[model samples]
Target: MSDIQPRRSYVPPAVRATSEWSWRLLLIVAGVLAAAVALQTVSEIVVPLAIAVLLAAMLAPITQRLARVMPAGAAAGLTVLGTILLVSGLFTLVGTQFSNGFSDLTTQVATGIEQVRDWVRTTFRITDSQFDAYFDQIKDSVGKSGNLGDTATAVGLTATHFVAGIFIALFSLFFFLYDGPHIWGWVTGLFPRAARARVASSGAIAWEQLSAFVRATIIVALVDAVGIASGAAILKVPFAFAIGVLVFILAFIPIVGALLSGSVAVLLALVAHGPGVALIMLAVVVGVQQLEAHVLQPFLLGRAVSVHPLAVILAIAAGSILAGIVGALTAVPLAAVVNAVGKHLFAGESKGEIEQELEENADKDPLARR
Candidate 1:
């Protein structure tokens, strides 16, 4: 009876398929986690290189035009220099404005603080002793967090890291602008000969997507800056120019940037004038944001990048969690590039069909042709 053997259990096809998928899914997740760990481990180099790539994408068209007349190396250098100068000029302007107006602004803020304290005292019945006790508690909590020496050491290390990152970014940007095609070719060469063409095609799609994202973001950011700055001016808010500059810079980071800069403007108005003016300033900020969200972003960025708002939000959140402000600033563009490359690689189109579509798109967009 034992020698005859029991019949083997028959597994359903659905169960078999599930078993196959379960391990593959686990492997995929494991690979992703491994890659993330590796990236984080070398983030000092990786982050700067990533920034260079983005800067290269944004400056590529300009570099190309410059290259037509000058050498590629020279063009890249000049482009980088120009970018540095532009940023420096903006900083100088903001600094000058802030310096000129800071004293008056501080006076206004001090008076406003007194008014706010009086209101709080009257409304909440919080006495001076209670306020002092609250402040002392806050100070004690902060003191317990770390000593002055530890805090200074952290600041020094951060500054050193920042400076190193700047140099790395600049060096990489030069090479990326001057030898982008050669670098990309070398990267593809790492793959098998049969897959090199496919890799190159995907890269092209990714570059196009990145370029489009950069262009659209610039326009959207400009519109936001102008809209908010104009509102501040119309409301006669103090430091309107500073607010505009700050907003323009912050607008580079999606979603959160505009909200933060707008809040600053609102706070300034409140401190300089009163709640009445601050309320109007807030309405203006909200109106401008509505226009940006509904009109400019949808019309410009939606068409150019073709990424969903939900995806953008999620990317920003993940990036912020992973890499802080730099991560948030870069998250959308990275997502756009990945989305485009993934679609091209996995769209199931034949080689000829893909080439034909790319050709058609190139004809429409001069930048894509390159």
Candidate 2:
């Protein structure tokens, strides 16, 4: 052969480079899909662990402050207890509001239903007998499907999962708070020796991102809840306290959750008052949301969790498609953490730059400073 067969195919350097990249990209994609499948299979544990991590991030500053005065275990315990008490108090308040308002709500709903029925009958020219027949048909179709037992089984399983998840979250949160550094060190130790330092740096960046996100989210949610609840109270909406609590809880899930929960307030207003009050309630909800979007989020989140609005929407959509409500709730924070960590790893910032970044994060959160 004349010294390597005279370049048999004459493949260009650009074409050869592209061919090399194409396979590597496909392999990476395949690996990602495989990982996703694995995660889904163990989602029960994964979900609880993820929740614990977020909760730990939220409680970390408090725990750290307490740790300065006491043992880490005690600090973690006290923090967890305080969180439980606060949550229980909220639930109790919501329950009391619900109990007090239920009778009036029922009356309003009944009256509204009657009015709707009358309007429907008049407009559609439907007789009572026709309505009864339609309802009977619906009942017959449901009975024919024979899914009641299956539905019951599904509900029971869901209840079990919920209880289990709660326990797992609590246990993981305790350990994460008490032994966070050791745990992280152990995890980083699992990597190859050469990668240990970079992995630890990436983890630190991720944790900072998560903490900033949780803190900002808490502030934003509180503001949203207070704003909406105050509007409801001013309008004399039924179960105003309950609506506020519900909004506080739902606002954690970002845009969709607030809208859905706000719609509940709107529906209650429509039933209890009328379309006039309901429209006013709707305006209040929209106004509060606008304030959050334009003012509060920008000031609170800043550059710490700087995910774009389009990315947020897309992440929410993808998460909802994958795992319903839980996925949607977690998607944004997860995306932000991933983005921050990915940037850190790829850019390989100098020690001074990393220290500067940490300083900036700490400046944003007063609790973060030693």
Candidate maximizing lDDT? 2
lDDT of 1 by residue, 1-370 (tens): 3678779999999999999999999999999889878887888898899899888878988988998999989999999999999988988988898899888888888876677677779989999999999999999998799779989999999899999999999999998888776777678789998776577677777777887778777887788788888988898777888888888777877788988999999998887776778889999989988988899878876765777779989998988877788888889888888888887778887877766766655532323334
Candidate 2 lDDT by residue in tens digits, 7-32: 47789899999999999999999998
Backbone clash tally (model 2): 0
Q: State TM-scores per candidate.
A: 0.90, 0.86
Query: How many Å off is the CA of 74 in candidate 1?
Result: 1.8
Q: Whole-model lDDT, candidate 2?
A: 0.84
Best by TM-score: 1
Candidate 2: regions farther than 4 A off: 1-19, 114-146, 350-370
Worst 10 residues of 1 by lDDT: 361-370
lDDT against the true structure, each candidate? 0.83, 0.84
CA shift at 227, candidate 2, in angstroms? 1.1
